[model samples]
Target: MKKKIYIYILVCTFVFRIISPAYISASTVYYDEYVTVSYVSDISGTSFPSTKTSYLWEGEHMVYKFQLSEPTIIKAYFSWSQSDEVPGGIAWFSKDMYGVDIIGNTAAISSKNKYNLILLEPGTYYINYSFGKRGSYKNAYNIGLSIAGQKVNTNTLVSASSWENPNVIRTDFYYEGFLSNLQPSAHYLFSVSSKSYVTIDYLFKQVDNLKADSAKCTLYYRNGRVIKSQKYDTRDTSKNKIAVLLEPGDYYINLSDATAPTSLYVIAEPRTNTLTQSIKRYTNKDVTVWLDSSYDHERALMVSSKVTDSNIRSNTVWKTSRNDTCLVIEEDFFTVSENGWYTVRTEDENENYVMTTINITNIDKVPPTTNIVNNKTYTSKSITIRFDDDVSGVKSAKLNGKVINYGKVVKAKGKYKLVITDQAGNAKTVVFTKK
Candidate 1:
């Protein structure tokens, strides 16, 4: 009785736990915000310390400091004149702890962009800006910043065309799970079972002028061998690129910029559906060619066939692009001076190739016929059969589940003797009674 009571208590605890809500820590709550910083140096003849909201060319670095009551997140935004090749800018953090540094060569940030900074336990941070060279024209911008569920400031920081932009700028706290930490120098393989082409969408940042001719693409196989190399040309202003016709296999994608070392990306899980020779046949006369195309995108259809012998007069018998499943080749008449092997291939929409073989033998193909006695009625327990042409092979007959035998060998029942031949042996069945 005591043991039963103890077991009952254990079951109650398990049930109670299953119905209970999970506990969450206070740190599980995420905080997010945005910060915008525009630099328009004193290029518009606008004087600072006057009606202008920002300084044009102070000739000194501008720093913004924030004191924190608790740890929070921050992001900075800015833009430089790309229209006239104005000096570039870079940004980084200058706090007591040297927490987070977000800096890249001077570039445009017209679109809403964000970069990550370190997670602060509790501290102050100063965002500083420096331009490479100031142009003669001051640019306009609206920098939006947010911190710990709050907006940092609404003011715009414009730089004069006379000051240089920093090498890097911007900082923010991102959701721990939201960003991908993949480096651009990694390669991976992708698998696509069907025998077809593959397309890859490549995303990259420009290292130097967009007109650089050294911007190229390099592909590497899993064995670390170079497979293909090609140059990229695009008129689209968008920053994404695409590559096509890559066989399925793990590969390394290298984006070579004229200005810097090549960046690499990984492509995992490669696959292929390639065509290979299936059979070899010898033919002096026209023969129908049949191929297997089961491993393609859809049904296999005849694409094209090439004639090797100039004297062979044969026309295309049948062809289709609507995925006929079976890859077949038909010829009106095959005429050849010499006997050799012929090749047939099937292709998918993506141009993946599948191949099959055919062998042409130098044998006579005389039509063989069957002669049935007592046309309508066959022997009660035996069937009378005769062949128009002499049958050289002896085979057994099977009906339903019973095997019938008579002598050392059996004659062909008729032209339609239901003959099935293989390398092992030959067999023919005679059906007299329906049952």
Candidate 2:
């Protein structure tokens, strides 16, 4: 009887050793390093949220880390497959591995889903999850986590200056994660090197029974002062926009109170100096008028008889070219059929004027006249000749096809040929004999 009992005890001890190793290995299947949880869209229906998942078996655990740049209210979600027999799982938020729980532990029970809304400050945090040893069979458990609130740190910087292209920044604001009780907001930062005109354009899309009145945007100074603010309704389209002139400084823009996702575009255009000058040109030809400034599609060249007169024609070709290093010139072509003084002006959307005067006249066609007559006898030792041009003045005079000073005295000893030409390329010739 003692020998039989000894054999049974040895067999039981061997079985216990084998089973203990498997239990230790299963309990130690935890992640040594924490996985970072970044925001990712996993939205459905009217909820705009991001989700991250981790898997664990019975008696195993996992940890995830996330950082917040600003104070935000976030929703934490822990869920698993509904088909599997309900496994006992618990999750909690903490500042570190050994820190006390910021939000008390939440259990995943027969419901298969658990969520909590907690406001967190700007800092790094960790979420720890564990599957307790309740079920005898090993089963995989999926844990889902998410956060939602003001995403102010995700800002786009805008530089609005003449040298750079018009700055346009765009973004989409949506409710993040699975939390529907809290709305999402976005923030943007921009700087104007000088005074500029800024336009804010946005499109609001209703999410599952949400109205447009739930959306709004505000512009603020760097010092937290409000500059301009507007709300949107169902009728608010991209065409409905806000325009404001901002001084040289940094500014902030915020969009909030949105029940649905919204798309927004902010355009900042720098102010330009007006160019005022005059040009004298001949009619029946095309003349190019240019200014050293940036190009804008909204600016158009306008033509009229007087500065104050209503514009008669605005059909002019405008083009932009670079003439020197960092110098841009905007040029417009103007043509006239008759002679007159026409005002050519261009105005930006902000009503800033750039204007010039064009004095047009017909080309000189009449030739110069002279006192010398053809086949006339002149016996004097020296003769004085005079030249006159009515329209364009006399350009030059020639004697015997050789250019000479005009109004100069000449010797009248033999047959002489004289020629005169005007500034308009008109010429006249005369032949005379001296006896």
Q: Which numbered prediction scores highest in TM-score against the true structure?
A: 2
lDDT of 1 by residue, 1-435 (tens): 111110101124343233211111101111122123222321122211211122223112234445543322233444332332323333445452121232222223223342223222234555544333322224433222322212122111211111132111111211110001111122333343333344343433332122335455556665658766666444442333333445433444444443221222222222232232322332223444434344433333332333343312223422334434223444311232223355455445555444333444432233333333322434344444443322322333333444433321333342222232222242333333211
Model 2 Cα displacement at 61 (Å)?
29
What local distance difference test score does each model get?
0.32, 0.52
Clash pairs detected, candidate 2: 49-176, 49-177, 50-177
| TM per candidate | 0.33, 0.39
